[model samples]
Target: MLLKEYRDYFKTELLPVYDEKEIDSFFYITLEAFHQMKRVDLVLKPDFELDGMQLLQWETVLHQLKEEKPIQYIFEETEFFGLPFYVNENVLIPRPETEELVEWIINSVPEIAGDRKIKILDIGTGSGCIAVSLAKNLPEAEVFAIDVSEKALEVARRNARQNEASVTFWHQDILNTDILSETFDIIVSNPPYVRNLEKQEIAKNVLDFEPHLALFVEDHDPLLFYRKITQLATKNLNRNGLLFFEINQYLGKEMEDLLQEYAFENIELRKDIYENDRMTKAVRKSYS
Candidate 1:
């Protein structure tokens, strides 16, 4: 079957489920993943063809898409912070807002000048996106990441190796731990902040296919992870150390309050590209 014909068929089948732009994105991304063909290649060779097996593969993906499966989970990979990461049902696919959190951390740190090395930790490091990205970009920092799920940690470890970013992975559950083993110069988390009541607002693809363990919190206590991490920060963060979080947009004010209650200084809440309050940063009080 010709690639162009298949593209049209793909679009038609998915038009009811997704918009034109998203369908095009899915099509080109799958084309590149499965056949190593870029959009320009398809345009150049208008008559490009797919063999029987390739057609079968595309058909399988089409069915999955129709069922609202995430393309990243279907492909078992994604790009975050311009770095390749392997993702699966065991971990949540990295989101763009979280990338913004990473950038905030990277920019907040001054360049290391001497033998001084900064230590960083990522709590709930699903897929290790934040930790790996920071390690890749800030080569001088010693990065550590922790996840409760062993399977999630497996994916995170592979991503660290794939990106050639040196990160230490821990399998401890942060909620169960009383204190971090070591103090960090910076700590960051994009932990489960979505309230149960907000599940209806989530897209079908995310609601159905993404790991809920990494995406949700009890509606009664939406800031569970943030509170615990902030408490830990008070004890485990170096003096004047920075803490960052990718927060639920609706709870930005609450997040700031939590940090303030913990006596963290210089708290700042920032919005993502969409102008939704999605991230927060605070400095550990020098006296604490």
Candidate 2:
């Protein structure tokens, strides 16, 4: 079966389930992942054939996509912050908004004291995207990550190793913990912020396939992770330390208020590429 032939199949079948652009993306991504074939290869060798077994696997994945399984999960890997991470049902797929959070941290390194090494911690690290990205990009910093799920931690550890980023992974529930063994210069969390009530807003692809343990909080306490992490940050951050969060767009004002209540100064909220208020940074103050 020629690869070009499948393009028509996708346009006819997948277009009903996914937009034309997404179908095109799936086609190219599947080609690259399975055959190491580039888009140019398809155009240049329009008659190039797919073996029977290859066509079988491609059809299988097409069914999964039609059921709204994410392309990332189907491939079991994704690129985040310009690095690759192994993902599974145990870990949530990293997002572009979270990459913006990481870029914010990387860009803020100049504000940190250059005389000493910066210490960074990522709470509820999931696939360890933030911790590994920071470790890889900010090599001078000491990076650590914690996740409650041992299964998720296994994926995070693999991601750190595969990315060659030195991040220490810990198994601990962020909400139950009160203190770290030592203080950090920067603590960041992109923890479970999606309230149960907001689950309807999530696409079936995510709601069905992603790990709920890493995505949700009680509807009544949408700020559960934020409040707990801020409390821990208060005691666990060094004076003048920084705190950052990839936040729920609907709860940005509540996040700011929570930071202010904790006396974290210079609170700033920033929008993601989609213009949603998606990231926040605050500074811990020193008492003279």
Candidate 3:
């Protein structure tokens, strides 16, 4: 089928389920993924046609889209921090808010002396997006990541290799661990902060298809991971080391309170581009 004809067909088939903007995005993404056709190529040659096998691939992806499966999962890959990452049901898809958390860490590195090597740990490192991005951008950082799910760690390890970032991967669960064997200069996590009660706020695509094990906590104990990680940080981080978290938007005050109770000093809660409270940073206070 001609590209223009297929575009129209996609709009007709998907518009009822998705908005015009999302349909456009899905069409372009599928075109590039399945046919290696760019939007410019489609515009220049509106007669660009899909072969029989290509059309079959499109039909399969379109059916998955109509079922509300995430496009990233369907493609088995996504771009994070300008680096490509392989993703699947085993790992949670990296979000833009977490990218802001990463940028915050990268921007603060200028204050640290360049010659001093730093050790950093990422707890609950789902796809290893945060850890890999940091290792890639801040080559001086000795990055380590831990996750409860070994399957998730597999994807994270692959991402670290694919991005040429040397990150140590661990299969330990943070919730059960007390102190890490080695001290870190920085500790960061984007753990499962989504409460069961807040699942209504998430989209059907996420709620239905995304890995719940990596996205949710009990509604009564929404700060479960935060509290445990904060305690671990106190024991495992160097004096005055930094701790960062990509938090749930609804739990900004609670997160601050949790850090305060743990005596982490200089706590700062920051917003994402959308102006939602999405990130927090705290320091393990130094003492003479």
Candidate 4:
């Protein structure tokens, strides 16, 4: 079939479930992935043909889309910080917000770009997204990552290896124990903070497809993971160390209060691109 014909087919087959915007993006991205091509390729080669087998592959992804499964889950891979990483239902697909958090950490902290070595720990590293990105960017930092799920850790380990980002992966629950035993110059987390009350606000694509273990907390105690990991930072962070978190949008004040309560100094909360109060940074008191 011709490329135009395939585009029309995508618009038709996908229109019932997705609006024009989503349909356009899904059709463009799916077609590109299948063809080892890009949207510009389609624009330049409008007459490109889809062989029978390729059409079948596209149709399969279309069927999965109709079922509301995420396209990223369908592709099983994504790009972050210009590096490729594998993802699955066992781990949450890396999102733009987390990317902003990584940027915030990379920009805010003192990443020794030359010969100096720095220690960085990523608590609750999901797909190893944050850890791998930091490792890729900060060549002089020793990046360590931890996750509670062995399966998730397996995926994270592979991501580290795939990205060639020399991160240490540990399958330990941050809340249960303090196996780290070493101090870090920076400790960061994008832990589960979506309270049960906010679950309904999450889109169906996320609620039904993504792992709940990595996305939620009970409404009664929404800051459970944050509180725990922050406490861990207090014990495990080096003097003059920085702690960072990508918190729930609504909990900025609460998170700030918690950080202040712990005697953390120079607490700062920053908004993400969408102007939501999303990321935080605090420093432990400097020891002479």
Candidate 3 wrong stretches, greater than 4 Å: none
Candidate 2 C-alpha RMSD relative to the actual structure: 1.2
Candidate 2 Cα errors over 4 Å, as ranges: none
Pairs that collide, model 1: none
User: TM-score: which candidate is best?
Assistant: 2
TM-score, model 3 to reference:
0.97
Q: Least accurate stretch of 10 residues (summed lDDT) in model 3?
A: 106-115
Global local distance difference test of model 4: 0.87
Q: How accurate is candidate 1 locally (lDDT)?
A: 0.92
Q: Assess each prediction's global lDDT (C-alpha) against the native.
A: 0.92, 0.91, 0.90, 0.87
- All candidates' TM-scores? 0.96, 0.97, 0.97, 0.93
- The pairs that clash in candidate 3 are none
What is candidate 2's lDDT per residue for 58-173, written digit by digit as tens? 99999999999999999998999889899999999999999989999999978985888999999999999999999999888999999999999999999999999999999998
Q: Distance from true position, residue 178, model 3, in Å?
A: 1.6
lDDT of 4 by residue, 49-162 (tens): 888898899889988998889988999998877788899999999888889889888896653233558899999998999999999998878999999999899989999889
Error of 2 at 160 (Å): 0.8
- Residue 37, model 3, lDDT: 77
Among the numbered candidates, top lDDT falls to 1
**How many residue pairs clash (N, CA or C atoms closer than 3 angstroms) in each of the candidate models, in the order given?**
0, 0, 0, 0
Q: Kindly indicate the candidate among 2 and 4 with the higher TM-score.
A: 2
Question: Residues 1-288, candidate 3, lDDT per residue (tens digit)?
Answer: 887898899889988799999999988898788767788978888777888988889889889999999999999999999999999999999998889999999887765535799998999999999999999999988999999999999999999889999999999988889779899988999999888888789999999988899999998899999999988888898888899999998889999999998888899999999999999999889632
